[model samples]
Structures are given as structure tokens and as C-alpha cells.
Target: MSFNPDILDIISLTIGALLFLMVLVLIIVFALEKEYYAVRKSLILLLFPAFFLIMPFLNFPYQDYLLLGISGLISLAFIVLVMPFNNRKKISDYTFSNKVDERDIMFSRIRLEEGTENHNAYYTDRPRNKEIDDAIKANPSLLSEGSTYYNLFQFASANASFDTVEAYHDHLYKDPAPVKKDVDAKQLSGYIKAWSKKLGAVDCGITELKDYHTYSKLGRSHNYGSDCKLDHKYAIAFTVEMNKDMMAAAPAGSTVMESAFQYLNAGSIAMQLAYFLRSLGYESLAHIDGRYEVIAPIVAKDAGLGELGRMGLLMTPKLGSRVRIGVVTTNAPLNIDKATFAPDVIDFCRICKKCADCCPGKAISHSDRKNINGDIRWQIAQEECFRYWTICGTDCGRCMAVCPYSHPNNFLHNFVRKGLRNSYLFRRFALKMDDFLYVRKPAPGSPPQWVKKNS
Candidate 1:
């Protein structure tokens, strides 16, 4: 095909026009979202039109082919430069053995009635926590009228989902039927992964259950008296993507509604996984929503899913902390991915304390990671976080919404993530760029149009 000069001119103009339009759209969107950094970046991207326009004037034979080759080479060079600084490593030297006492968690303690055996025993063991506990008790409580942003309708709606999730707790722990025939481990794993995907899981991973994953005692529900002893040998952890539109309304009713909806989605997936394991003659238990016997984030970390971030949430490379986790504890033998701890993520969190800055309750820590129960981790003030939730009449997720890593799971963000994973230089550069594009403490955006209409 002969390359006509007019055709080349037309193509260049089209490209430039599309680029300009995209930049304009981005600027308007950012302005509405109140994202100053994004607005500035969009303005910069608008300059790409000049380069696109000049391409036609410097017309050479097979110009498109030459441009493609140059682009590829540049990308390759960028990757090569960034690869060395990626400090992802497996830390076999550090091992966690402390069994978490479930009674220590706020949820478990919230369910405790004053003067009850469980409550008395809990207070007897940790007298220092009693004063804080009493203070939390003094509040009107979640789903109560005294909350600052209380919406009785929304609170009730969320409670309905929680009630449904609680009903499935017993079914998850039930014993399975006998396996009459031999089963393929790999095939079963693939099946579970596919099934989970169909059930709305964005990612799935498996790991051998460690003693540190399960809590030492039963917290919440009627199982308060039971000792925390999970005999399961393996854990299946999965994540559900949070809706960006809904999450943009952080610390609001819409955000809580979205959170409740995802919890139900995760709970359904967990219940299904446990039931499937039971059908295969393997013992399994689903830890979903309010009825968790094990720490989901810890299991998720061991499963090679992601690292724990500053907000004390699982920071997956793809979705960051804007994901809901579901875990199924089982005895079903399966292949496990080696746990990887990305120093880059930890480093980024250190430099980018946006979550701490944007936290409404000041629950996130401003300090470095500490040795909590033998593992180096950031400890958030759970009492304060939950107290904020009760006051707001919602589980305020401001930290999750404003995180740079919590950008929508799309090509543009993933491209940035690829660079971030390959190079510490890129990680640092990206963080700075992110802060420039999205403010270090971006304001909470409005809910989607649909949500507003419904409300």
C-alpha cells in the first residue's frame, strides 16, 4: 500500500485531536473530583498534541514502523533500568508463632456483656483494656441514633446483609461428605479459582496454614467461650474488588452500602468454597464478615497475595487496600506460592503517609512499623477507628479511598504498577508523580449519580 501524504496528515490530526480530547476530559473530571494533581498532569498531557502534529512534517518511509520500534526500545530500557532496585524478598528468618487472642479484637469485646463470664474473664486477663472498653460501651453504638452521620435506613440495610452472612457461619464449619474417588489437586485448585472468579473474586491464592494465622480464642458470636484452635492445614484467600464510584464517597452512607455489599459478595464466595471442599471430603471453614476465627490479612500475606500497608490492610499490587478479603480454612492439600514481601511497598508507605494524613479518626499511625506479636507491622488504633465508625454510622474507609494504590484497576494504573514493581527508582518517581496528580490528601468525592438519585 502506497503511503499518501494526505492520509498521513489525516491520521496525525486524528491522533492529536483524540489526545487533546482525552486530556480535556481528564481535566474536567479531576476538577469535579477536586483532584488538583490530576488536573495538572492532564494539562501536561495536553502538550502531546505538538509531538503528534510534528510527526507528519518529519515524514519518513515506514514512519509508523520506526515509531513502534523506538517506543518498544524505550519501554525495554525503562524496564531494565528499574529492575535492579526492586527489593522484593522472602524473609524466612522471621517466623511468627504468637496465637492471637480473639478477645483482644474490638468486635469480640463489643459482643461481650458486662458481668458475663466471657466479659469477666476477658477483663481479668487484660485489666488495662477495661477502661477503654467501658468508654466504647458508653457510646450510642453502631446502628444507633446518636451517631454523627447516622442514617437509619442505610444502617439497617447494611445490617440485613450482615445478618445473612452470620447465618452462613455454621454451614461453613460443617463436615464434608466422604470422597469416594481420588481427586486431582491441581485440577481442584483451578476449579476453585475459577469458581471464586465467577463468585466475584478478583484474585485468589492458597497457602499452608500457620499457627500464627488463627486467633487463640473465639471472639464474637455465641462461640465466645470456645478456644481458638484451627486444625486446618491450608488457607484459601481471595479478594473482591471495591467499586471505585461507591468508594469515592468515603466516610458516607454510600461507602458503607458498598462495603456491606462487598462483604456479602465475599461471604458468599467463602461459603461456596467451604461447601465445595466439604463435598470433596475435606474439612474446611469459611471466615467471612463478622464470623472470623482467623485473621484474613495474615493468611492473605502468607498466600503471596500482598503485604500489609500503613492502614493495616492488605495492599495487593493490583488493587492496593481497596479490596475485601475472604478466607477459607481447609485441610485440602494444595500447591502454595512463596510469600513475597515487597520492600518497595513498605518504603512507599513510609514516604507516602497519605493514609495517615487523610484518616478521619486519626486511627492510622504516623510512626514506623513496630514489633507487634513478634511481626513487624503497623498497628492502627482499632478502638479509635471503630469509634469513628459508630459516630459516623458507617465503617469510614477514608484511608482506602485516598490511597494512591487504590486507583481503578485499569490499563493506565497497571502500567504504572508494572514500573513500580520493577524498580525502586520507578516506585519513588511514581509516588511523587501520584502526589502531583492526586493530592497527598485528596478530599472525599461525591457518590455516583445513581447513588445520589436513589438517595
Candidate 2:
């Protein structure tokens, strides 16, 4: 049998390219800090490409055409998988129909002491939550000595971070700016975004402040049940990267430490941004730590930061649910972004329930989106989740840890993300591939060396 020289060159090129990709994938897996995945990817990449290269010599009938057919098929499959076609024209499906009460949130509920006036008033209004809230409170608390995975040093460190964040509560509120400078909204918005990144934020976005973004009432610390009335016209939302190593230790002390630490980082950036805006005479309020008037995720989504996921958290394109968000609600004239339709991510969430499966608290809903607070979205079992956090002496980020989307943000993972966005078939194949390479429930990675040595 004879083949054209051009056809031969094409085959050789395809084989050589795939062989190179195989090595590239191996290096990528290693760079992503995935040992098991590196091994599995290396074998698969090597074997599959080698099969294509050695096909002509396999002594099969019409081996030359068989190789061409196989290579063509592979190319066709790649083309189909990388094509972007989805619900881009549709309106965003996750918009809230109404505002959420700050008091209704678990963090707010946890602050209320039983027998106190606020507690009685709240429990009386929502009798259904009393029993659940009480049960959660009865557990060994978060960052406490009696809880599981309670490392004294780690808890102390996490506590210290939270304490600093709380201390910044007063800093969020500033006196009128003495030097009000005339600033360009577009340039200022650009400056804010760039400066936010300089201050450790991974992403920054702006949105028109909405009634839904603000909490209905005050629920934390002093001034409980007070009206959280703020007429801020614009909001700045940003996300900060949570260390992959720390987050991989999900449902463990390291996860809590990391969460708390990132909260501080986010808070710090928010505080700085707010201060900067206010210095220019804008009425900026940094919503951080335990003092929040805005629903951070909602505000972030509105700001084009990310889409809301099944776990009821912001799933950023880069970090998935592995990042913590911070917000600065202000009267600054910053450019606002429109809500982007991310049905691909939504579709992926519908299929990928790895978070729900791994959730120690069984907090994440496995079922499809339902009418929650009048919006079509997934609702988590808040009381159940808080109870597990209390049990672990940590936030128990197993959902974030096991999430396939929460893989490290790099070329390899980003390429898979792009594929998922582009093709539903690739999304399904990627999920299966994810399971094959990393398994559904990978063991919690060991804590950082500093944590281990100290603990």
C-alpha cells in the first residue's frame, strides 16, 4: 500500500503533536501539585498517542487508511468538543425576585443568644429555625477545643485573623472626606480594578447597587434588628485567592485557617478600596468579616465576578468556589457590569454533585434548582451546615475541596474549563475523566508544613 507524501506528513505531524501534548499534560499535572493525576495522565497520554503512531505497523488489513480514519475521527471529535454553542442569548436565570433578610442567615442567627430580646423576637417570628439553630449551637463550636480536628495553634491563628477583621468594623465607617477631588468615573473604575489586584485581589468588578444586595436589617453584634439603610449607588466586589494547599485539607483545621486568613485578605482589600474611594469624597462602606450589609455572592454575581453555584457560593471562572469575596458599597460613579449568562456552568452543576456527595454536613442540595426566596436556585441546609462546622472546629470546606471546578487555575485546568464552556459533550467527558484521574472522593491533602510543625 502507498500513501501520498502530504498525507504521510499530516499523520506524522498529528502523532508528533499528540506526543508533545502528552508530555505537556504530564508537566501540567505535576505543576498543579497533583501526584496521582500526573501518573495517570502520563500513562494515558503516552499510550493513546503511541497507539496512533504505531497503528500503521500493526499488521492489520488496510492499516494506512485505518490510521488516517482514526486520526481524522480524533480531529473531528476535538473540533466538536471545542466549539462554543449554548444559551448565550438568554437572560440570566438566577436573578433574585426579592431581597434577603440579614437576620435569616445562619451567621446572623448564631450571634443571637437564647433568652435575649433579639433572640426571642427572631425565634418567635420564625419558630421553625429555633430547634435547628439550638441543635447547632449545642455542638462543640467552631475553632473550639472540644470540636473534631481542633488544633490549638491552628484555631488560635484562625481566631486571631477573624478578630482583626472584626476590629476593622469601625474602620469601615469613615468621617466625611476633607479633600473631595473631581475624578473621572471610568478612569477611577479602571484604577480601582487595577489597584485591587495590586492589593491581593484576584478579580474586581463593579455593579449598580440594588435593594437586594443590601440586607433587610442589621443582625450582627450591636444594633441588632436595626435598619441597614444605605443609599450607595454603586458597589465594588472582588475575590481573593485561597491557597490550594490549605483548601485541599477540607473539613480540617487547615481549611478553616485558610478560610479565615482569606477573609482577612479580602477584608483588607475591601477596606483599602473603600478608604481610597472615601478619600476622594465618595460614601464608601467596606462590607467585611462579621459586619456585612450586602449579600456578597449576589453582589459579586451582579458585578460579573462569577455565577452562583449549587452550593450557594460564587463559582468564579478561575477559582470556582475556592475564592472568598469582598465588597465595597459606595456612592462612587464607577462603571457597572451586566450579568452574564453562564448556563454551561449551571448545566455542569446540575450533573456534577461531587460537592453534595462529599459534604460532611449534607448541606449542599443535590436536587435541581427550586424557587428559593423567589429565585430559581439551590438552597443549602444552613443549620445542618453550621452544625458540621461546629463539630469540626472549622468551616468544613469538603465541598470546595472535592469540586472538580476547584482545581488549580492554570493552563491545563483553564483549558478544561474552556472546553466545558464550549461543549456539553466535553463537559460530560471531562467529568468522567476527572473521576478517573482524581476519583470522586480524594483524601484530604496534608496541611502546610508550618501548620504541621506548629500543631
Candidate 3:
């Protein structure tokens, strides 16, 4: 069929509109970086679209068909050239044999009361921890002014959420009646994912429970004298994204606000999942903030969710460390994804030690991953890290803010993430580029202007 002028005009208008939108997006992204030269270069690229839009109006010697063909080819080339690198390896390749002890986590230890048998047993098993444990005990606790920027109001506000989560702990561990009907694993999995998403989960995955993911002894529960044993067969893990704007204001009221917000989100999802499993005639437990039996990150990692980065937090492909995780352990039979590790994250973290450099307490490790609990991993000094938080009266999330992966979940940041995943060469290049665009030790940014007066 022969192409008509009206048809050509319509095609030109659509392409022009799309091109303009793309340019506008690029401009805004570049503006966020505060880099003038990059913005200028991106603007210069807009010339091609500007010419195309004007060319449609001009009665040049060139045929419309030829012009259309050339424009289409140019657009195709641009897409190919601009496509971000994506080097994601199979989830199986990153799996490690390492097992995690639930007793080693700070939450578990914090749940220990002085002179408790579990606390005594923990120190006996790992005597070296006593000195560090003593150090934490000596500090002005969370919500106390002994912290660096302690704000009683903010700390208490954050604590209120934790209080609500505590109210759900007992309800999670209850057993349900047996179901007469056979349970469909696939259907149940789909229902859980949908419900989790509806409850504000950013991502969800299932994995078989491993010995290392559980604590050796019960540290947090009233059964503090009992040995820790999670006999559950499967674990359901999910993540809730943290707000970039709020987190950027690290060591401030806004940072605490974001932390509490996600904790509540994650907690709610876990509680619902546990309750749902009960309705289905199964026993399950929700491990939300402050209440836990299993380590959520380890389970999430095994479930092919993401890697653990330098800040000792899950670095999901989409949200990085700027997220909170919740887990539900159950006896239900289900398909599970083998734990996957992302070496690119490790490589990037090795070079990009922004968290270590920015930490106010210098608690994050600057050295390589060490042997801890029979696993090769970087160990942050938990006592020092928590002490800093107690002093600051905030979670002291400067590390989360400075992480290159903690950028806003927008197209611009996703483009960079795609590059980091696809090519080793691009991973190295993008790490340096991230440092350039966002400083290696970015200053703690202020909250939105509107929040300042009220805050």
C-alpha cells in the first residue's frame, strides 16, 4: 500500500511526542545528579528529535519514504546503543554452603535479659562476644539522649511501631486445624504472592528452610532458657521498599520515619501470611521486626531474591539495601527457589566502600569478608553500630543512603542497575560513574522543605 501524507503526519507526531517525553525524563534525571556537563550532553542529543519534528514540515528534496526509513533506523540504533548492560547469572551459580545461626543476630541478642540462661549459654559458646556485649550494655540505650543526635520525640515515634509489632508475636506461632482437602502448592504460592503484594511487599520468594538460617538457641522469646530450633520446612520471604527521599535524610527524623514505615509494612505482610497459612490448616510463624526465630535475609537469599551487600542488608535488584524484610516459616509443602548470590554485588561493594567511609561510628568493616559462623562475609561491629544508633537516637542509616544501589526506584536508576547486572565491564564502569554522579561520601541531605518547619 502507498503511504499517504496524513498517515506520515500521524506517525511523525507520535514519534515526536515519545521522543520529547524521553528527553524530558532524561533532563529530570540529570538534574537530580546536579551535573551540568552531563545535562548539557543529554540536551545536545535532543537535536536529532528536534530536526525530525521540523523536517516533517519542510518541503525538502528528500522523499518522505526515505526520510521515514532513515528515522526508523536511527531510532533503532539509539535504542541498541543506549540499552543498559544486563549480566545476571543464573540463581544457582551464587549459592553458597554457608549456614547462618539465628542466635548471632543483634535482635536475638538484644532480647536477652541480663543473667538469662540463653544469654549465659550464648556467651559460653562464643566468649569473645561478651566484651562486645558488655560494650553495648554500657551505652545509653535507644531512645536515650546519650546518642549523637538523640531526639526523644523521633525515637519514641519509631518505637511506637515496634510496640505494635510486638503485639502480634504470640498470634503468629499458633497452629491451625488440619484441612480435609488437599492443598495445591502452586495455587497457595500464587495466593501468597498476590496477598503479599497487596499488603505492600516489593517482592516475595519461597525457599526450603536450612539449618544455618535458624538460631541455635531461643534468645528473643520468653523461652530464653531453651535451645533454638526452627523445625519448619519452608520459609516465605518478602521485602518492602524504603522511601529514598526519607532515607536520604539519614541520621535525621525523616530517616527514622522511613525505617519505621517499612518495618510496619513488612510486619503487617508477615502477620497476614502467617494468619493465612493458619486458615489453610497449617502451622506458621511470622518473623517481623523485633520478633523472630529465623534470619530473614538468609532465607530471602536462598529464595533467589538478592545478595547481601556491605551494609549487612539485602540488596534486591530493584531496591538495594533500602528495604525492610519479613519472613514467615511454615510446615506447608511448597516449591522453593534455590538461594542465589550476586557476585557483582560483592565486586561492586569491594570497590565501592562508601558505607564504611560514611559510617559515623566507623562500625562497618573496611577489610575483606572474614570467616564468621563458617561463612565468608564482612562482619560489622554490631555493638558499635547499635551504640551509634543509641547515641544518634536514630537507626543511623548513613550507610543505606550512600549505597549506590539505594537510588530511587525510577527508570533512570533501573537503567544503571540493568547495566550493573549485565556486563562485568559495565559493572566496574557504572560503580565509578555512580561515585561521580552521587559523591562517594554524599553529605546527609535535608528532608523536603515542607517537612523542615514541622519537624
> Residue 423 error for model 1, in Å?
1.8
Query: What are the per-residue Cα lDDT tens digits for candidate 3 across 129-223?
Result: 88877777677766667766565556676778777777776676676766724688888888888889988998899998888777665555665
**What is the Cα-based lDDT of residue 201 in candidate 3?**
90
Candidate 2 wrongly placed segments (more than 4 Å) = 1-17, 87-92
Question: What is the alpha-carbon RMSD of candidate 2 to the true structure?
Answer: 2.6
**Clash count (model 1, backbone only):** 2
Candidate 1 Cα errors over 4 Å, as ranges: 1-41, 44-84, 87-95
All candidates: TM-score: 0.84, 0.93, 0.79
Candidate 2 per-residue lDDT, tens place, 300-350, comes to: 999999988889889999989999999999887878877786888888898
User: lDDT score, residue 161, model 2?
Assistant: 94
lDDT of each: 0.81, 0.84, 0.76
Ranking by TM-score: 2, 1, 3
Instruction: Output the worst ten-in-a-row residue range by lDDT, candidate 1.
Output: 86-95
Model 3 off-target regions past 4 Å? Answer: 1-24, 30-104, 108-127
